[model samples]
Target: MFYWRRVGRIWPVHLVALPLGIYAFYVAAKVDIDWPGLISSVFLVQTWFPDVTPTLPGNPVTWTLSVELLFYALFPLVAPFADRMRTRWLMVATAVGLFGMYLVNWVADATLDPTMARWVMRHPLVYLPEFLLGMTMALALRRGWRLPLHPVVPLAGLFGWTYLYYQERWPFSDVVEHQMEFAMRPMVGVLSALIILAFLQREARGHRGILNNRLLVSLGLWSYSFYLVHHAISRLATYEFGRMPDNNAVLFTLIGMAVVINVICWALFTYVEEPAEKWWRKHTPKRWLDRGGETGGSALPPAPRREAETAPAPV
Candidate 1:
């Protein structure tokens, strides 16, 4: 039950967070939320609609969930085809998919106003290539292909690209600058995949790194909850306190908020995400999950669980 597993992984936290975030917005921002948008948002289809009010409703950050939902719906169809392709060919297809995003972005930027262009670029369909890129890397790794990459190279590239692109520091013609702007999504996707591949290779080879420790690993586990709730908290804080003066004193406020966010995320993960996922798996319908004339639910044979690398990639 791939669909079931994905639903179980994603929905439990969303269900809890959605209303809570809506309430936070109501109290803090007094946002003129488009109510009908909530329905699409709950279904994780809000990003597919150009008319979505305020772009996202409820938890504004849940647009990523919309993207994930699209990926889940398409993964089975894509996976069978992807699994059959040789690693080289699979990468070729991924590259093409990513290139398609640049064209889509270019066309949207050329044809639409800035806001509509932004929305078009953000559409879930436009992001499927990033998902494919991750999958391609996973398959290539499994196929015993290795790249001579250190994580730092791509990590640095990511930071450098973000700075230069956002600040428009490079001397380029207007058309070239526009190309770089549109090219960001795909470029970042490739860089991100490379960073992940470097670490994946290291972990596969039984090496340990700073992130392999339990504290950070647990933080990583809590990150989804952190992502879900952090914005609401920030919204509430900003509304209550107003903007802090742009001085080092703001670091104290940031540190305090970070602590509070982690504490809340820890509670959310413990009470919601972990328990819900376990229960979801425990209760999945046999007919949906079992096809081999075998026992159902959590009865599948156990394997070494490197939870560090998985929370099932729904991210």
Candidate 2:
């Protein structure tokens, strides 16, 4: 997806996630003593559970990271399928089919074997539809499919989702658990699509948007670095200060800690993630065909172009 390419630039989203991580750690520390489990989960490094606290209060949303990574891996392939579905009806049908499968799985979970049910829930295959939905939205925008772009839609969607998220009630929980698993898909997708379209429209009409502001673009550039390191920093702060009473003093301390952690994360992002990504792209081998050679197992396209070139050509 074209947006996936821009995702590498998503520092702002981490700003949101970082605070939530701190809040999650604070809540988890308050809930119960599972020192051994928590420590083991943190150190395991191989599983998603450790990287993001899944069951913590105030942060049930972190499970999506596993799905996000899965999307990152598969997006290049899925983008093409999205590009091929020509009409809005087709896109809507595909999305409905995906949600229908989820509904079926929700029903099946009742009678399925315990191990199989868990596998089905956690498996990357389950999220392909969500990722494809996002890819489809991107494709739709690229093909000039018009959608309403009023700011209120995204603002309302965000507020509605947040309200539903915090209410922690029945239908909301069910919606969050299943039907809304991909809730952010539509909200973020619509907001971003509108913003991009508006920017294009403004440029064509000889008007510039605040998005052209240098500060916003710079922050956007640093956003990925912020994302990679923010959770770890939040966890570190939680471990150090989480045992304190939840008073204003404690809250301020935690906030201070979070700020420091974010600053450090920003530094690491600038010095580490950005440079590493660039180095990898520069040093990685290009396809043999592109290099005018005809030898080797399979000459994959260079890592950067791999996603775009592999994406299904638009029909």
Pairs of residues clashing in candidate 2: 11-223, 80-312
Please give, for residues 1-315, the per-residue lDDT of candidate 1 as tens digits. Answer: 777788889999988988778878764567777877888888888888888777677688998888888888887777767766666677888889999999999999999998899889989989988888987887666656777777889999999999889776467788889889889989988998888888887787787977799999999999999999999888888878897788999999999999999999999999999999999988878776567333333321233333443223221
TM-score against native, each model:
0.88, 0.58
Model 2's C-alpha root-mean-square deviation from the true structure amounts to: 9.0
For model 1, what is the error of residue 314's alpha carbon versus the real structure, in angstroms, after optimal superposition?
31
Question: Candidate 2 lDDT (Cα, whole model)?
Answer: 0.51
Mark the regions of model 2 whose C-alpha exceeds 4 Å error after superposition: 1-81, 101-105, 108-119, 168-213, 243-255, 286-315
Clashing pairs in 1: none
Query: Considering every candidate listed, which one attains the maximal lDDT?
Result: 1
**With candidate 1 superimposed using the best TM-score fit, by how many Å does residue 221's alpha carbon deviate from the native?**
0.5
Instruction: Report model 2's TM-score to 2 decimal places.
Output: 0.58
Candidate 1: which stretches are off by over 4 Å? 167-177, 292-315
